[model samples]
Target chain A: MRISIPVSVGIFLLLLWEMGCRAWAVPVYILPPPSEVLCTALSQYRILAYHGSVTLFEILAGLALAIAVSIPMASAMFLFPWVERALAPFLVASQAIPVFALAPVLVVWFGYGIESKVIMATVIIFFPLTVNLLEGFKSCDRRHVELFRMMGYSKYGTLKKLFWPWALPYFFAGLKVAVSVATIGAVIGEWVGAQRGLGYLMIQSNARLKTDMVFAAILWLSAIGLVLWWLAGIMSRRYAPWKDRG
Target chain B: MTLVSVEGLKKDFDGLSVLSDFSLSVDRGSFVSLIGPSGCGKSTFFDLLTGAIAPDEGRILWEGRTISDLSKKAAWMAQSDLLLPWMSALDNALLPRLSPKKSDRERAMALFCELGLEGFEDYLPYRLSGGMRQRNALARTIMFDRELILLDEPLSALDSLTRQDLQGLLVSLQRDFGKTIVMITHDVEEALVTSDFVVVLSDQPMSVRSSYELIGTKPRLRDDSYVVGLRREILDMLGGHGP
Candidate 1:
């Protein structure tokens, strides 16, 4: 019932938009009707799927790399106060610099290939993941750590048994945020130089005034983000089952 | 024979003394309760004894050996009932066992059942009541296989009825298991009823002001006139000026 309400409203809005576009005789270049967009999506389904899959692969690969790299960086910052101190300024600066500004530099360095796109996505995802994970590590119950010390558990033992498990939920929180913005990083990377991906396809169609195809590409991007967010929610549920109840 | 002894222990925090020239000794298989007012350094004393913090000047001897670490020989249960929130009741009890074997799990389960936590083996700590969590903690302390156990106001958080029940449990565990227990509590009646000796300490720059040996067997009746007089004496020692 909850899901169906918004879905029905969305269909109603699309119908209204189609009627307005046809009645006004609006140029397709400016605003393609939802029906025309749907037709274009079906007709160009094969091309759209190819580029969509490329972007999807980049998003997943970039997120995986970010998660891998962030864990160690976050751990170092958590385990040593001095390391956190040293890296704090640089971390803040990295986040402050717009990732979009770095997209062209990444394209130039890694060449107009998937490597640049993945790196760009990784840069966007890394900051939030590290910050969230460090916060989780630092927030473990002090009494629990004291108990671990009383039991003579080693530092690594405490990290594994207590810190990591305690931080899993926070990791998922950062992952959700990263997943939402992941495609933006990939698309921006593609817009800069990539010969493939939905971003590149949208650029090509827009140059030819094929606005219907551009609208179709955008619908595909929205679907990717929605699917990734849903997958992240499922993973969080599986890993942090204890967090759900009172 | 003395099982544990602290000699001239001194401790300070940022140049203000918490414990000064404090000394104590416990007999083998005896239960001792250190009773005092708040800020009397009972926790600091526990930390010193457990090797959690090094004393400014003192010596702690466990079984005639200079104490470096008590983790192998002593198990401690603090007031908060610090059970890991993520672990099940069974796993929390088995924490002290480094590499828990099948028998270790069975042993922990048996103790858990004995403590009235039979069906709660897999329940998380947050799911259990306050009393049940403390029982789980006690099970974990006992599972450590240590002869000496330190309990820091373990029942101070429970309601009166639950507190009395757990007091009874502690008495039985000491009598049946022959464990040398050192517990700290501010409750004069609790100290007098459950301990073989009550060590009363003065507040601030804390030092042992006096110690008394209680009469009678395990779980002395709280209503007995002799125990009643002892309670008043301990309460007065705790700075009770009220008429």
Candidate 2:
């Protein structure tokens, strides 16, 4: 029923969109019908797949870099209060500056390559992962800490046996959020200056007035986001199964 | 034979005094319960004993030696089980030793079996019942292998039946294992039944109001006339603070 309800609602919405376009005799350039978008997606599968793979690579690489950096960064921030105090403002400022505004600079510095897009995705993904993990570590129960202290657990021992396990759910929470927004950074980086990726394809298709192709590119991007989100969910369940019990 | 002795210990938090000139002595292989009014400094006393926080005045002596770090001498269990949710029951019990070998696992498994959590060793804490979780916590405390065990309202969160069951188990810690125990509890009957000595405390700026020696075998009957008499006397002394 959970699956059917949303699936049926989606089908109804698509039918309404198709009928509305036909009834209004909308210009194809202004808004192509769903059927035309689907046809374009099927006919141009190879090109879309090629560009989708590039965007996928950028998103995955960016996510990997973000995870690799954020875990240690969060640990350091937790272990040493000085690091968090020094970097907190900069972390917030990184998020405050629009990624779109920084896209062009990243392209110039990294030279319109996958490196720029991956870096962009990492910048976007870093804040949430670090903050959530830090919060998770900080959330270790005072009673548990006392227990560990009374058990003669050292600083490193407490972090490994207590804080790391405690913060895992939070890590996955940040990862899920990071995965959903991961495409934004890579795609925007591609849009600013890139010869590949779905973002570039969207810009190219829009310039030619191929609205159907633009919509098709959007569909592929959504698919990639959903897959990443689903993978994050699976990993979260596997590693932090206790979360589900609660 | 004294395992722990506190001399005129005073603790204050931001000018609010909790324990003042509090003194108590616990003998080796004895179960002692501290009962008092709500919001009393019973927990703070346990904290001082465990050396989680320092007393502003006076000192705590473990085996007659003034020690600041009591981690090596005592194991503490709070009201809540405080078990790590991510770990299974066996792993939680094995927390005292971070890196456990085959014998450690076997010892933990033996403790689980003895605690009646035999088949549930692999279960996470959330999956266990309230009583089971506390038992798991007890296993962890026992695994600490310290001479002294300090418990802060350890069975207050369980249901009445579970509370009674655990009361028996607590008595065994002193009888079978021969470990000294200091527990804080609101339940007068629990103290009467399980402890060798029951010390009553006053309200904030806690000091020993009185102490009673329960001169009888443990797991004492609730309806015994001597037990009944002592229970009423303690309750009356509490002056409406009784649980």
* lDDT winner: 2
TM-score of 1: 0.88
* Candidate 1 per-residue lDDT over residues B45-133, each given as its tens digit: 88888777899998888888887656567889999888877789999999988789999999998898789999999999989999999
- The residue-by-residue lDDT of candidate 1 on A191-225, one tens digit each, is 99989999999999999999999999999998999
lDDT of 2 by residue, A129-165 (tens): 9999999999988888889988888999999988998
lDDT of model 1 at residue B22? 85
Alpha-carbon lDDT, every model: 0.89, 0.92
Please give each candidate's TM-score.
0.88, 0.96
> Per-residue lDDT for A87 in model 1?
95
Interface RMSD, model 1, angstroms: 2.1
DockQ, per model, reads 0.41, 0.76
